[model samples]
Target: ARWSPSGDRIAFVSNSGEGSEIYVYWNTSNTTSKLTQLENGPSSISWSPDGKHIAFTMKVNAKAPVIASMPAKPKGAKWAKPPRITDRLKHEADGAGYLKPGFNHIFVISSEGGTPRQITTGNFNHGGNISWSSDSKNLVYSGNRNENWEYDFRNSELYSSNINTKEITALTDRNGPDYASKVSPDGKHIAYLGYEDKVQTYQLTQLQLMKSNGENKKVLSNKLDRSINTAIWASDSKGMYISFDDKGKTKIAFIDLAGNISDIVENVGGTTLGRPYASGSFSVSNSGKIAYTYSRPDRPADIAMVTKKNKKPIVITAVNDDLINYRTMGEMEEVWYKSSVDGRDIQGWIVYPPNYDSNKKYPLLVENHGGPILNYGNRFSTEIQLYAAAGYIVFYPNPRGSTSYGEEFGNLLYNNYPGEDYNDVMDGVDTLLKRGVTSEDKLYVTGGSAGGIMTAWIIGKNSRFEAAVVAKPVMNWISKTLVADNYYGYANSRYPGQPWENFENYWKFSPISLVGNVETPTMVMVGMNDLRTPPSEAKQLYHALKLRKIETVLVEIPEASHGIASRPSNLITKVAHTLAWFEKFK
Candidate 1:
């Protein structure tokens, strides 16, 4: 939902079985009105400063590719459905399967309600979060309009489009992503986030500022090491409110024009229920008031508000009170340790069993977070709580490759993943053991995706864990790099060149390469219809363990995607399965 410039009206979209449609509500009258009959809902809906119109991005479908086929069916005969054809490079996605031959374009409609007009024309997907000029006569957006956009997917340029003339002007021309434009209310400046393509495993996006006419570009947050995720201009345009990950927590702060950043609040995420991944959003009002998602370790998310007058945030919603408040929540503690590989500091979070006793011994469940670049912070997580409630101490570490530790640290896995990250995690585990939080005999491990890769690598490196569950892992990098949904995307960034070109290097980092020495009882699980890591990747581990006469179980969840915990049922299934598997060994 988005509030209009007038603050008296708000606009939002809703799905009514058919598709998403636009709706507007007037705060003064307490009345709502339907604005669109759209089958595919609009996104990035923004109201003009004058509140005379609203602009949004909507998808425009194109004709699918047609080819020569067999003869036509008989007059009244029923035949099979025609095969779907596609020639696009990145055709399918994880949750969203197959490609819809369409492009997102900007549209505008009057505030009183009327037909919407398309202002941009292209076969490219114009991103959302579009910014408009103070007069609302122009709009700035990001898109990969280059001819080779299919192959050069990483490169995107910010472009300004005139509402009346519909003239498009390119504002950025670098070989990296330049997106999320925010036109200052004064119409003098435009703030965006991007970074030049260094062609590495990970790169931090810097906050950039430029004139409205696209002149005098400069990096505003150069001195800051962490990647800024969101930015909003102050009412007076003196500075901007920005959000970034520091250590393992997401923080909201105000960054001035001179690059001085001051903290506003911490613990900015809890929207992701399945995992403790950093996720949340906030918006600033014209009066310098801010509204955002308030998060806690015991709750999912609640509506919170803050004003410049009062820096203290007032959480206005207790959406999970009925359920979360009634349940016993485990205690969460943040721990830091020195990586054994190097003396570099590493961060991790531990969830002790509910009503814990320091005198009692409990099994240790090492849950590795995915991304290898994404950090798991102290956020409310269903899976983490379940594991902790199941009577085990849970540890999820943000290793060397995790973000929020500067770009150098995140890119530490560049061409050398499963390298120092393995040691970083082990160091954390060993630290816990030394503190008497857990014992070696009751150690268990599990993770999905990159986390799964790490779990496999950890077990292969040492038989320390009594049981292991590896979910949706890329066992063989060579096979995974070529078969996964993002087949063409990971080549040069992950390792060097194509998988075949650097066969030995790819195989060296593959978890399957070390599976020969595995002795821990393992459970291999994956979504049957997963496209990211694919079920075959899990099958590789299951097959290898079987061939070696190792104890293993393959759990293929039907009709699920790479995100096995996307559905609430799936989330419960995953946690239950992991707990069940670990129980046997415990």
Candidate 2:
């Protein structure tokens, strides 16, 4: 989506027939016009400073496959399917299916309506975070045009291209991937985020500053150890505001000319629509007004506006007011306790069954989050709320390796993921058990992706839980490194070496290695089309349990990917299946 330079109008893409088309709407007049009819969807859209034209990124069609011969047949004779051949390492992606042969390129069209013209030409794909200079003469974007662009994925550089002359110039020359350049209001400096490619398991993305000519590059966030998720320059250019996570909570802060950091707001997220995960966005206007999505433990993101510093924000839109007013929600409570294995504090949230009795114990459901790099915070979660509504006490913990914590804590599982994280979560369960909030007989555990790995790990290590539902987990590292959507990072950065060099360590970390001890009635679930943690991974655990004469069932959500809850119906199905499994054991 592209907001006009004057902020008077907005242009966005929408689905049209078989593809997508661009449209512009006037905020004042409430008038809209169809702009372009393109074959493929436009990925990025940018409005020119004068609002006379729009620049966007669209995929260029890949060349047709080369076939040795074509067999002649009758009018409608059946032909054998062509085999896919590719020398590229990164080919297909989840949700996108087998990738089409194409690269993303930049294009521009007049706001008055005309044929769109292609700007940048290359075999390599151009990426988003496209920024236009104040004069509207040039466009800056990130891409890797090197010979081995695909293999050297972490070597993107910032480049500028003249809109008319088509002349290109390299702005920043760095080994690491550098993009997301936002030209300052004065157009003298550019603020972007990147880090040197040290090939480490975890590296913080530092906010950087450089001249318009790409000189005198400095890391503005050098002192900040936590990663910067988003950065926007203040209207004056003397400082910039950034949003980052700290210890499972997301906050927005401002960094001034003297390198002083002052928080503008805490708890800056509620963007995770389905669950309480760390996600949100903020934007600043030239008039110094800030607009963001406000969220809390009780509600999802609502439109909020703030003009003054350290002042309360006025929420403009209450998206969930009707639902919130009508439906009774579970009570959310924050819980903090030290890890039993290590003397470190762990954060989690517990949702109690509505109209609960403090004296009576309740069934416990431990939900693990994906992205050992992601976190669960004080945000409204539908999945958690649904479990609570089902008369279960739900606990979602941000264990070690969860982000929003500092770099050290996020990288704690660098070489030991699903290892000590188990202890951290089990300790959280123990905390509730000791308080008599949950009884051992009614314990249940479930998680997806990385959480799925932990769920499998939990049942294998301990049988305290009555039932388990492991969803979309990497049952074996060797297979995951080969088939997972992210084929490179799993071994290269997460571990020190390739599977061949570190076979012993890889085998040791795999959840399947300990499946022999499984005795719990486990339900292995996965998305039928999950590329991140393929169905094979779930099958491995199912087969392992069956071989041990253990009670187990495999559930595959049809037409779903890594994110099983991506669709509304799928989310309901996931929750239904989970509750059924847990209830059966109870």
Candidate 3:
């Protein structure tokens, strides 16, 4: 959905199916009209400031490449299908699978209704967010329009396209990515998020500003340590509203030209249901009002707003009230402990069971978070809460490589992942154990993706846990580095070079390398179609455990991608299977 410049109308596609029609709803008249009927639905919709035209990006399919073909069969006979051919570095994604042979091009349509006109051309994808200049004569967007765009996937530059002439102009020229361009209300400057390529595991995305024509680029968020996720210009063009994760919490703040940030609100997430990674979006209205998706530990997102008079936000909508009000949720608490490896203060969250008894001894579940770069904050997580409700004190920590902590902390895993980050997780566990939270025999560990890698590493490193559930993990880095859907994207940044060039470095960090030492009762799980960390990775662990004569089981979810929890029933299946497996050892 895209909001009109006057904020009086909202343009949205009519349906999710193909051939969806764009419809504009007028707030003043409470009327709606079909704006356009396109074959494929439009995305990245943006309205011109003058409220005259709407710009969106759409896929324009290209003819499939054909090699040698068999002779044309008779009309009645249906011969075998032709073999598909692909020579691209990234031909398929985890969820999207193989992509259509086409490029996404920008198209413009009248706000009223008209045939859309394509502006940008060529084989490059201009599908990123579209922002308009204040004058409404030009459109700004991000794309890798380079000749070597497919290979240099990490690099992107901002481009400005004249609506009438269809002339494209590059506005950024850095080795790293420079995208997410947001032109100020006054059209004096353009702000974006990017960083110089350091060829490292992680880099903080800084806020940068330049003149409308892309001159005099300067980093405005140099003083801010944490990466800024979203940036929106103030209505009056004084400062910008930015959302970022600080420590373990997500915050919405205002930053002036000098980079001084004053927080407007905290808990700016609830959209990511599977895990509590940083997520959410906010936008500023003309009269100094901010609307955002409100987040909390007890519930998912609800519509919220804050005004200049009331700096504190007001939750205006209760979308989850029916489900949340009736449920007795676990209590979540945050704690900070020093890392045994470096004496760094590591933060983690403890979710206590519902109606807890201080006298009772509850089993502890160490639920490691994915990303290895993403942090698990004190936000609502149905998965973690489910574990807590099942009578285990769920402890999720933001280890050394987790984000929101400065760039140094997040990039510590460069060429050393499953490295000290493993110690950071164990240190949190040891701290809780020393406080008599749970004994060694009652411990259970589980995590998916990167979290799964850490969980496998944990159980292999020690025999304290009663059982372990390693879901969709990279058991063998050498295999996974070349096998996953994002295989080409992890080479130099993750390690020093290609897997073959740095074979020892890759294998050294793999959990499969430590599989021989694992003694915990294990249940390895993965989505059957998980391309990110494919089902083969899970089977490697299962086969190894079987050969070792260890108590183990394999659970493969069918028709699921890397995001097994994307479907509600799939989420239930994952949690149910995890509980059933953990229940066995208990």
Candidate 4:
């Protein structure tokens, strides 16, 4: 709801079975009506100060997908004619291909109702969390429009355009990445996160501020030893609220124009999902009330509301209540251990089987996360829960390269991954065994993407695991670089030299090099159309296992991409097959 210039009608987007439409309920008229007839959908709606028009982001499906012709119709007496394929890359995409062709950008529609006008254009994709100027004369957005767009993943910049004139202007120019730009309520200053490129494993982003015209840029919380998650401009426009993590816990902080920082809430934001690694998001109302995503050890992330007057937060969304009533899922507990290689403390989480008992021993499934850079924080994850509910103890750890920790700790595996981090996982397993929570005899391991790569590496180096499943892994670095999407850029950044310059280095770190020593009964899974890891990587491992006459199976998820388990049905099947493979050995 938007406060009239004086403050009254709240305009909101509602789905009425047809599709998502915008509706403005007036305070005086006590009436409402549809403002748009968009075929796709619209979201991120904001009001103009004068209440004359509403600006929103619309997703339009511009073209129908193309399909490849299959074998001639099989001996059918009568059959419906086949449709022509219009999209070239339709079948190649898992779920994303089915989506309409379009990019998210600003669109202005009369608050009363009419046709909506698209404002921003180009091939560059716009970032979310958009905001409007106080006067509603302009709109601000974040996107990376570098010359090498596909390869430049960390070069997003802030931009602003006139509502009527459509004059676009670049806000900030930094060597590193910048994003999450928010305009102050007064429309005088902009707040965003920026970081310098250090060629390290992960970029350390700092809170930064500048004038609306992108002048006089300065860092606000440079002294703080944490990366800013997101920031919101205060109501008075004098300061802003920021979120960051320290010691594996998330905290909400307030920063003033003078660069002073104060912690408002500590250990507050964590959505109920996997092990808690610091995960949550907050949105502040004009009145200073903060609504955020909250989670606990046993639940997934839900909406929570917080105010300065009430020191405690109130739960706003209870999504897991019904699910929990029908079936009990395993609860997660945070576990920490010192790495055997460096003595550095490593953090991980353990999810025991549902209705767990200490007297009975259970099989352990060590799951690795993707990104190798992304943290497996406490967030709602269906795959992990499904494994736990299937009577397997799941273990997920934030090895040396995981985020939430400081830069020094995260960069430990920049160019050197699957190295000491391997020891980190082994040490975690030993710690659980020492605590009598897991047995070495009934151990299995699995992971996807980078985690999948590690799984292949683990089975090659050790015979401790009885069974293993590696999903969408990069078996050979030399072939992976040419096959994967954004191949040139990712390969250049992760490795010190090109494939020709340092052939031995790539072979030294690749898991496929050690496939000859693998003895564990392994199962390989991957999306048939995955561009990131590609199917050939999985094929290499499958062929090697078959050549050795070892017990192995290769399951290819059809019409899926790098993220094989994106769809609800695919996720269910992914978990079921993984559990079935492990159950065979058990």
TM agreement with the true structure for every prediction: 0.97, 0.96, 0.97, 0.83
lDDT of each: 0.91, 0.86, 0.89, 0.78
Q: Which ten residues in a row have the lowest lDDT in candidate 1?
A: 13-22
Tens digits of per-residue lDDT for model 1, 1-586: 8888878999998885478988899999999998987747789898888888888999899988999777978999999888999988888888888878888899888877889989999888787578889998998999988998889898999999999999999999999999989998799999999999999999999999999999999999998999999999998988899999989888889988888888888868889889999999888877888888888887798989886567788998988899877888999999999988879989999999999999988999999999988989989999999999999999999998899989999999999988989999999999999999888898999999999999999999999999999999999999998888799989889899998799999999999999999999999999988999999999999999999999999999989999999999999899999999998887
Q: How many clashes does each candidate structure show, in the order listed?
A: 0, 2, 0, 19
RMSD of candidate 2 to the true fold?
1.7
Q: For model 4, what is the C-alpha lDDT against the true structure? A: 0.78
**Which portions of model 3 miss their true places by more than 4 Å?**
28-31
**TM-score for model 3?**
0.97
lDDT string for model 3 (368-440, tens) is 9999889989888989889888999999999999999899999999989889999999999898988887887
Candidate with maximal lDDT: 1
| C-alpha lDDT of residue 156 in model 4 | 76
Can you write out model 2's per-residue Cα lDDT over 95-119, one digit (the tens) per residue? 7777878888888889877899888
- Which candidate, 3 or 4, has the higher TM-score? 3
Error of 1 at 153 (Å): 0.5
